[model samples]
Target: MTETSTGGKGAPATRRLSAFLYRHDRLRLAGLLTPPILWLVVLYIGSLGVMLVSSLWGVDSFTGSLVKKVSWSNYHTLFTEPVYRTVALRTLGIAISVTLIDLVLALPLAFFISKVVQGRRWRYALLIMVTMPLWASYLVKGYAWRIMFDKGGVIDWMFAPLGLHGPGLGLTATVVALAYLWLPYMVLPIYAGLERLPESLLEASADLGASPLRTLRSVVFPLLVPSVVAGSIFTFSLTLGDYIMVKIVGGTTQMFANIVYDNVGVAGNLPFAAAAAVFPIVVILGYLLAVRRSGALENL
Candidate 1:
């Protein structure tokens, strides 16, 4: 018989690699996760750490330049300065108002689209309508609202008959624009949660002689809390960090972000800007921790 060339003892490279991966699931998982993990740790967390360290440094009063001296001067200025305190509080209030407005507006519409709408086509159409605004430029949307809030703009024309006036470029206008911009963010998550709810649970509530309002109050609202919280997190954090909208719509009012921007650009105080930036980071982190304890993130 012939001496067969059995391709030696070693397996092909592809077969070897496949066998190795199959034998080591953890290795496969680590390979899959390495890119995202590196990005998050290096880009996001590393930048935050650098900012935090910079915030701890001091600034030169005469030259208006950053001083590398490690001290608590920046944070001390933030805490001791009355204007910083006022801006921080004002920003928090506006953020909360935007979140509440988005919640109230989104809840009813999300429920209607997810439950009340009959067919798949109609449901998708309504979803597209809800998401349509997101396709436009953020600056364009802000400027459009600015025009609408102008003295002789559409808002004034619409409510002129009622002897009312638009809020104009101020805190109220800022809140309105923020709420409008973030409404879709709130609606989509709530809609998804509502859609995933079981029809039988609602029917059981009805069969048990529960009123529609009672069914909603008892069966639906509790289940929706996590989704609402998730949406609020986005609306709250976005409003907190936004400077452009405030610049466009907030005439004289200054948010925390405005303070940071002014320090960086106008004042040429990098250390102070970094310090001012820390307040929003702390506030958001605390809010996230609170929501985490309430099991919101788990549900998400």
Candidate 2:
């Protein structure tokens, strides 16, 4: 009798708590979101805050120890140094090249898969092929490109008949490899946007006596701009932060990412590395702001 009474009492309390939560929608939402909010605050924002704080500190030149004092010396060096400026420009150029190359390649392929392909099965197959490279390891893809660009490799063999040579490992190779790697990122968004586009609009354009080129230019291209910008965000930001690809196929080329890596690993200067790492973050934030201003983020 005593055990039964205690069990009955606990059941009512549990039911009451459940009923309270069910009645309070905002409270229930807060309970559900609290864990993820805590994780974002503690892990992501906390780490960035630590890095920013460390960037403000300096390393003692003589002892190679960290100085606890806060100073702007690291940022000062990055702004004032010519080599840093050169690496920043080179990194920006490479990123832009990769984004443009991917954009040009993705547009037609996405159009064909989403619009021209006759059957659902064929479209799915092409999409699978486009995304298959992503399943492979990043290092594997980089090294594969390295082999293709090697002297007397597949590229050279193919071009031998044309009396040409492979690009070898350099900026050209870096741009090509980066483009190939990020092509799927560019293709999928444009493909989705094309899929969502109404065929009635195209039919109306044709009915209005617009040529194929005109329909594509005035109708398809304008509608697709938001998706293009969305995909460019991925490609551009990725290329900006890439270091391993350049190391594999960049020959002697040094990107901004390479500067950050070298500072941390080779130079053992954490403060400076943290500062150098801010360059890409700033650039990406600026890009996001520009995209936001253009209203492309709404599509995303």
Pick by TM-score: which candidate is best?
1
lDDT of 1: 0.89
Q: What is the TM-score (0 to 1) of candidate 2?
A: 0.90
Clashing pairs for model 2 are none
Indicate which candidate wins on lDDT.
Answer: 2
lDDT of each candidate versus the true structure:
0.89, 0.93
lDDT of 1 at 226: 83
Model 1 agreement with the true structure over 115-208: per-residue lDDT tens digits: 9999999999999999999999999998999899888989889988999987778899999999999999899999998988998999999999
Find the 10 residues in a row with the least total lDDT in model 2: 291-300
